[model samples]
Target: MAIPPGFLDELRNRVSVSEIVGKRVKLVKKGREHSGLCPFHNE
Candidate 1:
């Protein structure tokens, strides 16, 4: 399923991608984005 770009932008504006992802994994802010070891593959 393809999501609308406007909807994606609105959702991103209302929430932090890192925060939501942080719920399942530990994340650290690196510049403007988040980074963490991948748990699935243990990178």
Candidate 2:
């Protein structure tokens, strides 16, 4: 199947760790960034 063009680039740019983690953790705004527990893996 053919994937949509620029889809990967868009995903990389938009899929913030905070956005993803916020769904599963308590996220807080830290200055210009967001912080939260790692959702996809551990440090």
Candidate 3:
């Protein structure tokens, strides 16, 4: 099934990226963006 328009936009607005990512990784606010080490890569 196809998703309706504005659904993703509304979801993104409702959810928090930092909040979700912070649960798995430590995030540091760098200006307007959040910085963190990659959990998938061995770098």
Candidate 4:
């Protein structure tokens, strides 16, 4: 199967809620995108 542009592009790093919370994020796979927590702040 083929993946979307934005999806593969963003996966290069980590999952960003700011990027997700702003738009429609459809997870093709469940729990795989849990990431290291929200990618908003550096902490």
Each prediction's TM-score versus the true structure: 0.70, 0.44, 0.76, 0.26
Q: What is the lDDT of residue 10 in candidate 4?
A: 79
Candidate 1 is scored at a TM of: 0.70
Give the alpha carbon lDDT tens digit for every residue of 1-43 in model 1: 9988699889989998888889999998899888988979966
Give Cα distance to truth, residue 19, candidate 2, Å. Answer: 1.2
Q: Rank the candidates by TM-score, best first.
A: 3, 1, 2, 4
Which prediction has more favorable TM-score, 1 or 3? Answer: 3
Local distance difference test, candidate 1: 0.88
Clash totals in order: 0, 0, 0, 0
Top of the candidates by lDDT: 3
Error of model 2, residue 15, in angstroms: 1.7
Best by TM-score: 3
Please give the RMSD of candidate 3 to the true structure.
1.4
How far is 34's C-alpha from truth in model 2 (Å)?
A: 1.5
The pairs that clash in candidate 4 are none
Q: Which candidate model has the greater lDDT, 3 or 4? A: 3
Candidate 2 ranges beyond 4 A from true positions: 1-11, 37-43
CA lDDT scores, all candidates in order: 0.88, 0.79, 0.94, 0.54
lDDT of 3: 0.94
Residue pairs with backbone atoms closer than 3 Å in model 2 (clashes):
none
